[model samples]
Target chain A: MSGSLLITFDKVWKSYGQGEATVHALAGVDLAIRSGEFVAIMGPSGSGKSTAMNIIGCLDTPTAGTYSFMGIDAGRLDRNRRAMLRNLYVGFVFQGYNLLPRTTAVENVELPLIYRGAAARERHDLAMKALAEVGLVGREHHTPAELSGGQQQRVAIARAIVTRPTLLVADEPTGNLDTARTHEIMELLTRLNTELGLTIAMVTHEADVAAYAERTIRFLDGHVASDAVNLEVAQP
Target chain B: MIWETVRLSLLSVRRNVLRSFLTLLGIVIGVAAVIAMLTIGSGTTEKVKADISKLGSNLLVVRPGRPAGPGGPGGLDQATNPLGSKELAALVAHLSGARAISPASQKQVRVIFGTESLTSGVTGTDSAYLDARDWKLVSGRPFSDSEIRSGTGVCLIGETVRQQFFGAGDPEGEIIRVNRTSCKIVGLLEPKGYTGFGQDQDNVVLMPLAAYQRRIAGNRDIDSIYVAADDRTPTTELLPRVEDILRDARRIPPDREDDFSIRDMTQIADAMASATTTMTGMLGAVAGVSLLVGGIGIMNIMLVSVTERTREIGIRLAIGAHEKHILIQFLVEATVLSLLGGIIGILIGLALAGLASLTLAIPFAPSLAVILLAVGFSALIGMVFGFFPALRGARLDPIDALRHE
Candidate 1:
């Protein structure tokens, strides 16, 4: 059964600059992602995939048309209000594994909760649980520099889920990983999507990465080129 | 939440120890200058007040001159008539509210005892000189009234003179030659140490006015008259009376200015103390300018730090950190850094002040209020200078910042 829509974009347009030099990043893009769905966004550079992901995560607002999240017109909200929405509902994992350098893994995971005004003890416990879920229990005290690429990515994932956010926005999460590490990270993400029914919108260029998602959306020339279900992949 | 932010800032500060210390140097020197100047200034003020008090309390000095004006030579005026025994006798007889009236004239003369010879200030006055000056004798007795009237060669030697000629032996009954005349020592004057002007107060000898005029000065001109006010009288109230008595004793005409000047020691004390306070304030203000420069230094470094940590700011923002959070974090970092500099500066400053006090022979006076104000001011400087850079960091666009290398 299809779940209710958690994100919707109705002809969303994001433009840069003004007048003749203007470039449209997202041109009248329309898309919908349901709760509990793992969607992969595929496109070449400047194909509006990253722009759509930013809009979905509430990091940026559309220049025209509506971008709604859960039941709210998020594009119309102010920067601080959008920041609050993002903090409450969205988590981000970046290609660079953007955990703060020189900070312990557990401390990095507690960062989002710090902004949430969580008490120290409660934040520590939640961060510990999140780290354990990411299979980084023994490396909680290791800094990013001390951890390997895969381990650092796992810490980033722990940080992303520490707040138990409703949606996870991952941009090229496995782009820097090797073949084996990529498979391991993909399996961990798939298990999270199935067991927790967490909504995930990941941006990636690889075909195998897209196949791991339940649905794949392709963009070209600032518009959605195609959307299809991955029928060959086994359902959870 | 504040504690977490503070901890984060501390970690950031510690990450670059050398840079942090260099950034703090300006504040340290500024605070140290302020503390040292203020502490030494107050100590000098105390020394000046103490020196003035040592001259005498409730006392006035009548000198034979017009009051000195700016750029003009001070003390005795060459054109005016010198005070003599007539002025002294006039005050002793006509002036009321005066506890004692004594006249003194001084000259530097070589004194010889056996093979040892030293230059000494020889002062001539009456038996009442000790009472008027608030001076005491360590041993023996002051000159008798008969000795003062008859010009006997009896004199009292100060501690410095006794140390030079007697070498810790008893000076009483010992005869010392004063400018070719031999005088017998009757008493040992108590030690008064040195004045703030570095003038030695105990390197002299005291004798009767009659003996000094007859044997040493060979003249009856008195240099100054010492008038001490009674217990119930204020110097301000006693000043005019002495002036009137002196004018009449000299028979100064009503149309002309008086030939003598009477100075109140209490007034001079107040003026000197106020001058010292003004000097201290000026030094402190100059030091305050350095603190401003130090604050600007903080602002410059904080701006550079914000630029360097743009990506970190983006990471925090992406995870939902508010603008105020970023602003407060930088502000706290700057404050903690400046406060640490202030503490170190205080210690160094006090040590410098203590050393100065030891060398200059002034009291070591450290004021609590000044130290507290320095602490508060350094913190305020951090907040004020840190505001602009912090605002810049807080206003950065998350996407743009994240894209920064």
Candidate 2:
């Protein structure tokens, strides 16, 4: 919480290929965020919001310039070390709620812990705590298909936070939900933000979704178009 | 982690129970085919070896023919003596490793015992001939040397002949007749099962060599001579010396071919073993084609699995799984499937081999090494076929995968 900047993007650029036919995924973007901040990236389709989130999450690296997280140069880590960093430092929630279909809710939450070789009882305890945090205490046995859309997303969010990573990235967490479920998901995410002091980065095309965060960044054609604090924020 | 993948794969199989069972059927058939082919092949080989051993170890048969005179080559029969007596005597005298040699000259004649008469062989041979044919005295003893020298009225009876005359239990010292002449049955031979050529083994009688030379047939000429070699002398070390002595005795020039033939045990064994091994290999190759088809089945199932689990893979990769994790997961799944089939096949194969052996009345020989080899080979097939689809699954773009409808 005391750090000046938890993440720094110094003119980062990303391209899919080498030639004229290359896709300019993230074109010369520059940004920084301090610890304990909840930010939303707002953009239209093909506007590079997902690319920025991907680089910030350490799932991908920039093609040029530098991106640093917690002042440890990100690009310097090898492929395996980068993976280790992602496992240790970041958690992601995708739009699809990608909770392994055959797995129960608690088992989905335990996925990251399993990868780190946590003992069974310890992982189960942690996963139970995560499920309880998302108000899924009695629903541990439910699979993704067995739960409602918002409940499934909450299980996914529980999974994202089970490892207690410093950074949480959610991409369109409520895209599949109705308005009521969307509001519930928004409230849950915001509570995780202000209450747990987690540094959050999210991408959404909805204005209401962007208004739920303390800060919002706008992207257009692979560049940050605007950065502003929310004047009329929606609280959970 | 691999075990977890296997558990999940098993769970998935349970979820699609029918499809999974169908997929495994191919592997079952493939493994069963391999095991069955190997079992039958080895069983047949054992049967052949037993039949050959029944012919007697380290003995060769010499027949009078130029291979049955195929294109009317006008080859001679047993009367012509393609294997000569002089050469056989030389084999007994000069060959470094030979034990004895005796000629066979028989004229079909009526063998009588009181009023119980039968038409049977009147073959003539020396004492060494009986040893070459693996016969032993069941009662009394073989004809004496004096009897052989005098061409006396003494003969050795086989169990069959004695049983027909004396009803088996007490035929040791009995009397029989040959060509209407009374001869004393001085000995009875031990019972033997059957010949390599399927003739009844207990249907023969032995007469003194000089007795046959003088009494059985009027002509002084002999037909084929059976030669016996010492057991310690390998055929490789004996054939050339015997051939040289026989060549000298037959009065053939250095460059001219002799009018006789000689064969040995080692060549026959080598030839039979090689032919059987080759036939097994060829049959195994045919069975292997079904294994490849089973591999294709694995590939198809794996491709379907990858396509169906794309979103799960995307989430796993997003959550920190590297490409290798996904690869190992699917590879292990496929291997488990193949190994299950292998185990089932092994049990069935052993059962099948047992049944065949019981029916054929031969020894049941199941090698654990061969079973394990088949299992390992099937697992290898799974890995080879499953790798490509697993790579495709591991490399899917998370964004596109998550977005897949």
TM-score of model number 2, chain B: 0.76
lDDT of 1 by residue, B267-381 (tens): 9999999999999999999998998899999999999999999999998898898899999999998898888888888898899999999999999999999999999999999
Candidate 2 lDDT by residue in tens digits, B1-405: 666778867777777777777777777777777777777777767766766655556665444444333454434654344554566667677766655566777766788877887666677776777777566887788767788668787878777787777783676567677876667777778887554346666777778766776767766666666556668877677766766776677666897654555667547766786677689778878878888898889889989988998887777777777778778888887777777767776777678778877776556877777788889988988899889998898778665676676
Per-residue lDDT, model 1, residue B132, is: 92
For A123-186, candidate 2 gives per-residue lDDT tens digits of 8999999999999889999888899989999999999999898899999888899999999999
Model 2: lDDT of residue B325: 79
Could you tell me the TM-score of chain A in candidate 1? Answer: 0.98
**Fraction of native contacts (fnat) of each candidate:** 0.60, 0.43
Q: Isolated chain A: TM-score per model? A: 0.98, 0.96
**Model 1 deviation from the true structure expressed as Cα RMSD, one decimal place:** 2.5
Q: What DockQ does each candidate score versus the true complex, computed on alpha carbons? A: 0.71, 0.38
lDDT string for model 1 (A125-178, tens) is 999999999998799999999999999999998998888888999999999999
Which candidate has the top score in TM-score?
1
